[model samples]
Target: MLKTYSVSLAVGILAGLIYAVLDVNSPAPPIIALVGLLGMQIGEHLIPLVKRLINRQPVNLHWFRHDYHHKIGDNPPPSGDKTS
Candidate 1:
């Protein structure tokens, strides 16, 4: 995730620099571009949920648990050690 964010930030900075040097406005205004990005992000998250629903699978939100160590590349705590 950090790598993805870094690459996106770099590309955005480069694009902005190019536009500034050319003294040309961005083809899409910032707010319009932001809204498009928001829509894309929403779709990215929703697609999986929609697919799961179509397949009649329960939507699992286990990853959102406070003690979900998987996100840190660590083994999840043993079942007996689970805080919840």
Candidate 2:
């Protein structure tokens, strides 16, 4: 989880810097903002579509791998599992 967070932060900063540079030369701020927002929406939609097309599978979230771990968090062993 910590690793994922760190990577996400790096990607987010890179994206923001790119966006700022693009916006700086834009002729009209309002129009540019609208287009930027639309571009974001299209990119969001396209990413999952491209991913599905490439992988040919539904995406699985990382957290589901440990569903059982979360459910029994910090619990002591049951009586039947006695140690010798």
The Cα local distance difference test for each model comes to 0.66, 0.59
* Cα error of candidate 2 at position 69, Å: 31
Q: What TM-score does each of the candidates earn?
A: 0.43, 0.39
Provide the lDDT at 50 for model 1: 80
> Number of clashes in every candidate structure?
0, 0
Q: Which segments of model 2 are wrong by more than 4 Å?
A: 1-16, 19-28, 57-84
Q: What are the per-residue Cα lDDT tens digits for candidate 1 across 1-84?
A: 999999989978886787689675776588866875787667766776687679996665553343433534566655664555
Q: How does residue 20 of candidate 2 score in lDDT?
A: 74
Worst 10 residues of 2 by lDDT: 62-71
